[model samples]
Target: MFSSSVHYWLEFYVGAYHALKRGYSNMDVLVALGTNAAYFYSVYIIVKALTSDTFEGQDLFETSSMLVSFILLGKYLEVVAKGKTSDALSKLTELAPETAVLLTLEKDGSVISEVEISTQLLQRNDFIKIVPGEKVPVDGVVIKGQSHVNESMITGEARPIAKKPGDKVIGGTVNDNGFIIVKATHVGSETALSQIVQLVEAAQLARAPVQRLADKISRFFVPTVVVAAFLTWLGWFIPGQLHLYPQQWIPKAMDSFELALQFGISVLVVACPCALGLATPTAVMVATGKGASLGVLIKGGNALEKAHKIKTIIFDKTGTLTKGKPSVVQTKTFSKIPLLELCDLTASAEANSEHPLSKAIVEYTKKLREQYGSPSDHMMDSKDFEVHPGAGVSANVEGKLVLVGNKRLMQEFEAPMSSEVEEYMSEMEDLARTCVLVAIDRVICGALAVSDPLKPEAGRVISHLSSMGITSIMVTGDNWATAKSIAKQVGISTVFAEIDPVGKAEKTQGLAVAMVGDGVNDSPALAAADVGMAIGAGTDVAIEAADIVLMKSSLVDVITAIDLSRKTLAKIRLNYVWALGYNVLGMPIAAGVLFPFTGIRLPPWLAGACMAASSVSVVCSSLLLQLYKKPLHVEDVPIPAGPGDGGSNLV
Candidate 1:
């Protein structure tokens, strides 16, 4: 008895004491109460027999000792299972290499010397060499050499992507072949891998709304069980004293008070509040970690809870549904100026812009110059660069007022668009292309017809969402004709065009909407929707405003996020049912409710085992989320035909 008390004092008695001091009761209080009662009562019985020669009584030391042993064993197993739920997080943290090949660069942009150094010493603008099969040490842009990088661990992309000069590489991804020199752009905590780890850690600490129900029940659960145990003792002892049952039902060596004590001890140990307390958090932890592995970063339990109910998903047109990498497909000159000169002025004005369309224009001009055999490595500098949201950009390039954007920018600057320019824009819009009008010195000079192709999976993903009872809508700042053309290609029935950032949010006002986007204009809508999923490659503003982030930047992950949420919520419900059902049925049996009818009763030691098993079982059930798989398998689905094929390729 002394040894058992010493073993359990800190684990149970002290915890119970602290809980009472804080004005609350927990599972430890029940454990301490039940074990102390059994232990002290057995001591009392032994003392009584020792003092009197004729008196005898049964002792319960074995019951108290075995109960604590079983409870402690259960706790150990529960902790081990909980650890298994975070294996994904552990693997992620292990991806970054400890050492990197740092290269010293000369003034002429040539390598001077190379030395191996710890990755912790890496900083922005430092050049690092990555060889075949070595992990990239930090987020950087490839400055020299070419390779195929395996980004499966970081982006969940199974296929390796080809990398060349100017291509961006994420830290922790492996170089499949060849050697490359990378200039680090982000290091330490600013790296994508570090950000993902921090997000997952925060998510696991967040509590789900459904967990509150479990918490509310647990707060009252322990005290209620104690009362039930006392009533059970009264029910057995008073009835035994009144001869309410057959005297043969009592054990031969035990009297009414001893029998009552046995029933009370059994009741106390059988009702497990620990199971109820563990039901929700264990499941949430496993789900969040599993989500991180799949390149879906759920911000917290609140986002996970809201995602499952998204019946309407609003998709931003340019980057969300299309490839977001626009290329100049056709160019036209409106004035007497040469086409090459027209592109030169436009590219110069757009050089300072970060918009995807501006980059496409700049790229096109560079290629155009190469094709014309006048390849120049520099563009004329621009001054007074201005950005008009949802319109275009303007700047003074080479002493010329250059305005490059859509028709709205021309209208804003009162740049006259002649009949030919209007005709060219209408034709491009009908073909699902954006016409970027270039106005030089208040005179319309030329236009570039840029086309951002629909993502190959966009049509099929939309079709799948429709089959799952979700409605897909398109919202964009583009003209109505271009928006409708793109929507028709992707099988979306509804479209909203010419909407600014605030208007996009207003569009999601009255429905359970999920917004998927990758630009600054999408931030307001992302914050307003029931759930917002930002593309990992998107602007930081959009990512910060989103509830979930699709790190792979693939449209298919939208389906994965929603499907995973539904499955996780279902698992949580099952956990609750199991925990509550165990106590409701176990308490009555422990109280000997079936003893008279079937000659069966739950002994105190067996009741302790059952209580321990209940808590362990709940944690194990949560660990099952580690096996979760994406519902939509990209490999299994056939590639859709060209855009406007009405999703005929969906399998």
Candidate 2:
């Protein structure tokens, strides 16, 4: 009895004392009550037997000792399982390389010296040399050489991407072949790997809305259980004293009071509030970690809980559904100037413009020069370069004025546009292409038709969402004709065009909406939606406003995020059912509800064992989320055609 008191007092009893002083009780209070009653009662029985020779009772010292042992053992197993649920976060934290090869550069950007140093000491503008099979130490742009990088850990993309000069490399990805020099752009906490780890940690600490029910029940669960146990004892003892049942119904070594004490102890130990407490949190932790591993960075339990209920998703047209990378498809020259000369002049004027269409024209001109065996860099330099928003760019190349823009810029400059040019622009617009009109020396000389292709998985993902009863809507700042054309090709029936940032948010006001976008302009709508998903390649503002980040930037992961949330909620429900069902049925039996019929009764030690098992069972059930797999087979999805393949007419 002394040993049992010491064991229970240090652990369960102490915990119960602190909790009660705070005006509350928990599962520990019930455990302490049950074990203390059995231990002290056994001491009373021993003293009575010693004082009176005719008195007889069976001491319950073993019951109390064994109950504490089983409960403690169950707690140990539960803690171990909970630890396994955060394995993804642990792995992410370990991905950063311990050491890096720092490069010292010359005045002209040539490497002069190299030394190995700890990655923690890295700083912005520091150059690093990465060799084959080594980890990229920080997020940076490649300055020299080329290689293929395996970014599976960071982006969840299994294939190795080819890296050349000017390509950005994320920290913690592996360099597969060749050597490269990278200039650090982001280090320490600013690195992508560190941000991902921080996101996962924050997500695990957040509580799901569904957990409130369990929390409310647990607040009163222990005190209500104590009352039930006392009533159970009264129900058994009073009946026994009245001779309402046969004396033989009692165990051979126990009397009415002793049998009633046994039933009360069973009731106290068998009701498990701990299982109810573990139900939602464990499942949420596992699901968040699983999402991190799959490149879907869920913000927390609230987002995870809400995503499953999304009925409609609003997608920004440019970077969300389309590639966002425009390419020149068709070029027409109307002047006496050759097509090559016109393209060179247009490419030179657009060289300083950052617009996607400008880059497409410049790239197309380079490729054309290459096909003709002319030097790609032979274009004359531009002077007085200017960007006209909603129009285009203006510059001077070789002492001649050059204008490259839409018809608006042409009319603004009083540049003449003939009937043929208007016809060409209409035809291109009908095909969902943006026609860029180029004017040289106040005469319309050429036109370049550029198109941004739809993502290969866009159509299939939309079809899948429709089957799942989720409606897809397209919202864009582009014209109605272009928006509808892109929407039709991607299987979406709804489209909202010429909408600005505020207008995009307004479209999501009356529905359970999830907004997916990738630019600074999309940040407002992203924050206004019920759930915002930002593409990983998007601007930082969009990512900050989003509830989830798709690191792979694949439309398919939109499906994965919703599917995982549905599965997680389902698992939490299952856990609650198991916990409640175990108590509802086990508590009655433990309270001697069956002893009046078949002479069956639950021992205090066995009841304690069942209670411990219930909590452990709930945690183990949640851990099963580690085996989650995305329903879609990414490999079977066909790749979208490139620019050379009929100019990506799908969008």
Candidate 3:
């Protein structure tokens, strides 16, 4: 409320200056100084009447009146500080929808008029239509269509999440593309956004770590001030002894005693303990806000503190450590026939496939034809093409039967293999690649390797983690050769290959891992790991199942989370020092222990000021976190696995 700083400055300080001019002013000083003097007179009268004449009323009354002004100043500062910290809540509320579209009863699914319904009027089961680039109206489940939603405002992740049928949609997320019909499950205060607001409110109501120290000091504060008051009375009273008789010295003695009592109350008035109570939370709130801007969502002080302790990081292969796209890595020849002829046979059989592996096969075949200057539409004998579940296919090529598949397929057909063929397969498999072997008329030929590329940013982020002394591991379902190659490219030393979904969890458990992933199959491992990291990228089932979700799919955000935790912990340490040091050095000054030796006693007013400054220092330090210099760069940071190889041994 003290918005006019100039006006406030001229009034309080000017009044105190004139009052101090009445050299060594007493209760009567206000009476002579007019209204600034009159205010103290009224307070003195009340104290004198209330205390029942046990002690003289002039000084106690004067100081209590000034206490009102000090308390008022404290209240004003506290409100202003609280308002600054709570700005995040107002920003969140601004995301709510102002209007919505309601479905009409026409034969075609038509809209009644565009209804301008306030967010509070929205209810569960309300169907809302969201077009491209609009914040969602309510927390709902998608009933139709698809789109990408930007959830950075809510989850602090920059990645756009893909929302399709059956996906849970949050209110206030921006729709990036396509159209969707959302059936509202929660609206108004029941939404996740509202829940965040409630949590912040509760955090505010909780006791601060510094307040306990203030309470303990305040208990002895009054007694210390009383002693200081007695010293003041003695300094003036002793010199005017009047030959040690009662009647002769009583009048002047009464005057000095009253003045000292007033001084005692003044010290108490100017030294309220409010600032001590606000120190920690203000800093934490500011830190949380700064982290939000940097794409890091720290849920609470506890999580923020624990994050810096991450000693090991385990990465999930698909959609996390890799680019989520598997392609042909290498092609080799074991047969006398041309490579183009083998691909033609393989493509024909895989043309109708929707599987990612099959698509990789088909694409590789097309590329081979283009590279070899052959026609891509080469026809195949469908009669010889056979679909092999969980294996490679068999087809006819140039009037001879050719097989393109795993080594297991050879066993299935009771086909015989020589030592050389097995040796070649062994070398390729060691690289963690998915090898598709070629057999011409039942004779082993060459093999094609399939692999998923490592994400460009994965390497860089992992290296940063390593520099922070956290170990990195890669887990994949690919063969040994392919996994090793990709891991080497990224510079990761630990690799687990050909791991089943269950095996992923078992391995994570064995290593005390923190599993990071973004798929349904990865969910179990994410949950089982010591710290589950779910990478959000529009539709990461793994993120939903994990403990810590990275709303941004970038590996850099993962590193950002780790950095944020460390910095926050640092901030907390500073906070603890501020709290601990203030109390440690503050109590003795308040207790008047030094007055006997040096007479440099700490007045209650000065003690209050020091406590306020310490608190404000903590808050200001936290606010500076907003100016953090590091920008998040997710360039792939390769982490070498040292030679641990890929996948599991269950096969």
Candidate 4:
């Protein structure tokens, strides 16, 4: 009994005294002193009973017991609630498999055998075989065979990606089709999945700006309450000692000493700083987890808090709004061949080229064959292929010399160019499209107009942002003509074109700007903006510098991020109002402020229950944010009446 009281209970008393010595106070000190007062006073009553064979008033051993028990219960519930806020992160960590099947090559290296080994034992350059319906154990490139891998969990992309020889596969992704041999390139912590998990853990531990406010308020809250409790005791006890108290003002069951002690203890027991401390962090925790589930990763509380107030969102033109890769948007042919035939001839000639534009033309032709029909059942292979570096490519296709490239390639080959072809190429260049002219037997046959097309959702998302009264601006390092043409198509009116990376950052200074980009050049601007959002498909430099990452790589998630932030901030404000209001009204009532009127007074045990209830109420309110659902469309957001009328009704 002595150890329990001296060791366990004494810690609270010591902490309370320590806080007092520091010229501040805390909830622990108030709780410890409040319960100890009731217990020590009761001990005096017990000694009086033993000496005089008569006890006066009540002995409150039960009051102290209930106070400790209720507060302990509240603490346990708070821990449990905080655990639930991180469930999404737990689910992500569970995606990786523990073991992998190592592939051992037989003599002559023709046949291979499988040996099951722990994932930790795998290393770079080691070969592994993944069967259909199994997870890829580590990041690797396919060395043999072909299959489809589901990378939805890692990238938030729903469709399965076709994995062929030389294609890279991420660890933890599921193989959905044929078996494949993979040579490991990255292992263990070096994989993308591991990095994402670490980022989320760090983000959850970070504090927001509002949490600092709550901390400042709590530093003064406990000290003020302790003084209030002392004043309440003095006010009643002094008047009663002078025999000036009215009968109706005092409780029926007690005299001045009993009444004073009851009111003073109640005042200390009912005051709660735990509720105020939990208001912001708990809401941020749940909101971050909710964002991960929607493919939007919020790096920390500062990003979440700032994202809610973003007035202007600046988007980088090239990779953020567009597909970030050249595609065959328009194709025209002058010869007797059809459009699809011209594409097939161009694709066959450009298939062996390593240039991005050439690869785009080849890919477009492959898609055309799948959708419609191939012009030739078997594509003729090109011979004596030569790349002219910025000019184009030339090869002998089926004994006929075929050259596919820009006008420079056509001019060097001395290919015949008609007035009609010149007009066609000029029209494409004016629209910011790269022209890939196809020539067979030194005759200009056709041209493929390649360009980076805007993402299907970009225009709609920009229009939606405009409707929300939030200004959307386009910032890019590209030429003004190209930037203006892309901006007009995407519904953006403000364009900051021909600006360098450093200039992009300077343009956003002193504004609540959200810079969205996906390139190495965008890193400086991303770091300078109030909130940096990077596309998942972006370079490593951009992603590392960003505050938020969009795993879906869709412009719609920008809207989702902003909307989620507003909703999360709303929950935080709601929590603060509840906690502050509860303390403001309950503290005075517990101090017997109503005793002189209706003769109402809170007992010590009742005050303890109210304190526990207040903390639980704040936590429960934060948990309601888990019910948040993203809006389906812009129309789902309620429109305001005027321009300056407080932001959108997103909540």
Per candidate, the number of residue pairs that clash is 0, 0, 40, 0
Q: Estimate every model's Cα lDDT from 0 to 1.
A: 0.86, 0.87, 0.61, 0.80
Query: How many Å off is the CA of 377 in candidate 3?
Result: 13
Per-candidate TM-score against the hidden true structure = 0.92, 0.93, 0.62, 0.81
Error of 1 at 70 (Å): 2.9
Instruction: Looking at model 1, report the run of 10 residues with the lowest lDDT sum.
Output: 642-651
lDDT of 3 by residue, 59-84 (tens): 23333233334434554555655666
Per-residue lDDT over 231-252 for candidate 1, one digit per residue giving the tens place of the 0 to 100 score: 9999999999999987889887
Models ranked on lDDT:
2, 1, 4, 3
Q: Please say which candidate is ahead in lDDT: 1 or 4.
A: 1
As a whole number from 0 to 100, the lDDT of residue 56 in candidate 2 is 83
For model 3, give the 10-residue run with minimal summed lDDT.
Answer: 642-651
Q: What lDDT does candidate 1 reach at residue 16?
A: 89
Ranking 3 against 4 by lDDT, winner = 4
* Model 2, runs deviating above 4 Å: 1-24, 372-375, 378-381, 640-651
Best by TM-score: 2
Poorest stretch of ten by lDDT in candidate 4: 642-651
